[model samples]
Target: MPKQMNFIVSKNSFEEFGMMVILGTTGAAMETQMNFFFTFWGIFQLKKGYKPGVAGMPFPFKKLGGAMFRKMLKGFGYDDMWEMVKDGVEEGKIKLYPCSMTMDLMRVKKKQLREICEEPVGAAAFLEMCDNADAVISL
Candidate 1:
C-alpha cells in the first residue's frame, strides 16, 4: 500500500501555509495519500476568496513586507498559493478538511468555506484519520 501523510495546519501566515501546500502537493506527486486538516487561524485560508499574503513578520511592517515578498516570489516563477492549491485539488492529489471545533468557535459557516474543503471534522476525527498515516506533520 502507498504511504499516507497527514498535515495539521494551525498558522495563517503565508509562508507557513504555502509550505503546507508545497509539501502536500509534492507528497501526492510521490504517490502518497495526503490529507490536510486546517484549524484555528489556518481555517481562514479555506475561506471563500481568501488571498495569500505574507505574514508573521514584525508587527509594524508585516503587511507591507508580505506584499513585497509575494511579488518577489512571483518574479521567481512561483504560482500564487491559491492557484497551486487548486491545481493540487484538480489533480486529485489532496484532501482538505476544516476543523469543526474551530468552525463552531469562530462562527464560520460551511457555505463560507471554499469548495475545495471536503468537510468539517473535529480534532478527534482528524486524529483518527492520521492514526495510520506513515507520517503526521504539524505546521
Candidate 2:
C-alpha cells in the first residue's frame, strides 16, 4: 500500500497555507494519500472566500512584501494559493478537515467553510487519522 500523509495546520498565514497546498498536491501527485487538518486560526483558511496573504514578517513590510510577492507569482503564471488548494480538492488530491473544537470556539458554521472541507473532527479523531500515517507535518 502507498504511504499516507497527514498535515496539521495551526497558523492562519499565507505562507503556512500555501505550503500546505503545495505539499498536499505534490504528495497526491506522487501517489500518496494526503490529509489536511486545520485547527485554531488555521480554521479561517477553510472559511468561504478566505484569501491568504503573506504573514510571519515584522509589521509594515509584511503587507507590502506580500502584495509584491503575489504579483510576482502571478507574473510567473502561478495560481493564487486559494485557487491551488481548490484545484487540489477538485482533483481529488487533497482531503480537508476543519477542527471541531476550533469551529465551536470560533462560532463557525459548517456553511461558513468552503466546499472543500470534508468535515469537522476533534483532536482525537485527527490523531487517529494520523496514527498510521507515514509522515505527519505540522505548520
Candidate 3:
C-alpha cells in the first residue's frame, strides 16, 4: 500500500456521494491512507450541514430513489454519510481536502466547510498530493 490513494470528486449528488463513500471506506478498511479532493459541485459535499439527495434523478422518481438509497444504506449496516465521513477522518483512514481554487471561484469561505475538512488546498497542492498516488480517479 505504498501507493497514495486519492479520489478526485467533481459531484455530490446522491449516486456520486454514495460512490465516493464506498470507495473511500474500502480504502479505509484496507488501512491505506486516502484523500478525498472535493472540487466544483463536489465541494458542497464538504460544506457544513449539506444534505445530499437524488437531485440528478427526475423529480417524480427522486423521492423514491432517496428513500430507497437510505434504506440501502441501513441494510448495509451504516448510518448516514456524514457519520461515515466523521468516522473515517477520526480513524485516520481518510482526509477531506476541499479544493481552495474551487472555493475561491465559488466564493466559499473556509468557515462554510465542515469541521472535519482540512485546510483548503489549491490546484498545485492537490496535484502534488496526487503525484504519489497509485491512481487518481474523477467522478
Candidate 4:
C-alpha cells in the first residue's frame, strides 16, 4: 500500500481559519511523499470563480478595502495561498482532490474548480486513500 497523508476541510471561504492554515502547511508538506485530500469548504480555495472579500470579516472591509489588505500581505513576496498550492502541484508533490459529496451539495461543477483537482471522488474512495495514509487530519 502507498503511504498516505489525508486532510479533510469543511470550512467555507477563508473563514475556517484552521483549514486555511492547513492549506498552506500541507502545500509545503507536499515536498514530501504524501497525498492531500480536500472536502467541503476546504475546496473553496480551488474554486475557479471564487473571489476573496472581507465582507464577512469582523471589520467588513469591502472592495478596495479587501484589495488593500491583500496588497499589504503580498508585500511579503509570496503569492496568495492558492498560488503556493499550485507551486507544490508543479513540483509533483501535491494532488488536489475535491470531495464528490461536497461538490454535489454545493453544486460546484468540475470546470468551476481550478486545474488542481484530479477528479471529484466519493467518500468511500477518499477513505480508501485515507486508510493507506500514514496520517489523517480533519479540519
lDDT of 4 by residue, 1-139 (tens): 3345666666544444324434544655744434556676666756885655554655556445556666776796647766666666776666777888888888888888888668788889988977667778765
lDDT of 3 by residue, 107-137 (tens): 8899999898998888899889888888888
The Cα error of candidate 3 at residue 101, in Å, is 1.5
Candidate 2: residue pairs that collide: none
Report the C-alpha lDDT of model 1 over 14-111, residue by residue, as the tens digit.
77677887897788788888889989888987888765556666777766776787788789888876777777777777889999999988788999
> Against the true structure, what is each candidate's TM-score?
0.89, 0.88, 0.88, 0.72
Q: How much lDDT does candidate 4 score?
A: 0.64
User: What ranges in model 2 sit over 4 Å off?
Assistant: none
Location of the lowest summed lDDT over 10 successive residues in candidate 1: 49-58
Better of 1 and 2 by TM-score: 1
Q: Global lDDT for candidate 2?
A: 0.83
RMSD, every candidate, angstroms: 1.7, 1.8, 1.9, 3.6
Model 2: worst 10 consecutive residues (lDDT sum): 57-66
lDDT of each: 0.82, 0.83, 0.83, 0.64
Residue 32's lDDT within candidate 2 is 83
| Candidate 1: stretches off by over 4 Å | 52-55
Q: What ranking emerges by TM-score with the best candidate at the front?
A: 1, 2, 3, 4
